[model samples]
Target: MSNWSIDAGVICFSGVLDRFTVPDLWASLSSWKPTEKGYLVDLSRVERVDSAGMVMLIHLLEHAKTENCHIMLSFVPKDLGTLFRLSNVDKLLAKHIQN
Candidate 1:
């Protein structure tokens, strides 16, 4: 049901997070100012995550921390979740990339 949608603090990424990904996420994330404790990461669209993509997200995470904002990813696709887990990146990843 959720393919692409956004609110003030939520980005419903509902397709794929591979290759030319994360930039869109960056745009959406930069669309507004951080005015609260947390935001959201709708990875429902993110189907695959490569190293480059992960790097971008990690940068976002670091920036978020310095800014004192947060992102919570919900409903990540099954395969990507496995990929994330397999890469052992789940530990270093911030809280937003989880359900």
Candidate 2:
């Protein structure tokens, strides 16, 4: 299972973020709205991620766009970054990635 929390305006995620966990995480974030200055998504504690997790992150970015907000991803895992590159979405998500 995966878990996420918003603390100090940052969304922190932990545990595996695979197909099984993305759904619940997505549902839990339905009501989330980024602040005017945007939001930071911290994934440092996330142990694993798969395609589904990538899709969910993309969807979250899309959702933020609709609200005229920006979402920045931070502390991305190496595997997840590799997946993004392999999926050819690195460019699309590049602006949102933060070191």
Give TM-scores for every candidate, taking all chains together and pairing residue i with residue i. Answer: 0.65, 0.93
Candidate 2 — what's its lDDT? Answer: 0.90
Winning model by TM-score: 2
Per-residue lDDT tens digits of candidate 1, residues 1-99? 113565777766555555576666666655545676787766656656666555656666677777888877677666656666878887766456665
40-98: candidate 2 lDDT, tens digit per residue: 99999999999999989999889989889888999999999999999999999999999
Model 2, backbone clash pairs (residues 3+ apart or across chains), number: 0
Worst 10 contiguous positions by lDDT, candidate 2:
28-37
Name model 2 segments beyond 4 Å from true.
Answer: none
Candidates' C-alpha lDDT? 0.64, 0.90
Which residue pairs in candidate 1 have backbone atoms (N, alpha carbon, C) closer than 3 angstroms, thus clashing? Answer: 13-45, 14-45, 15-45, 73-96
Error of 2 at 94 (Å): 0.8
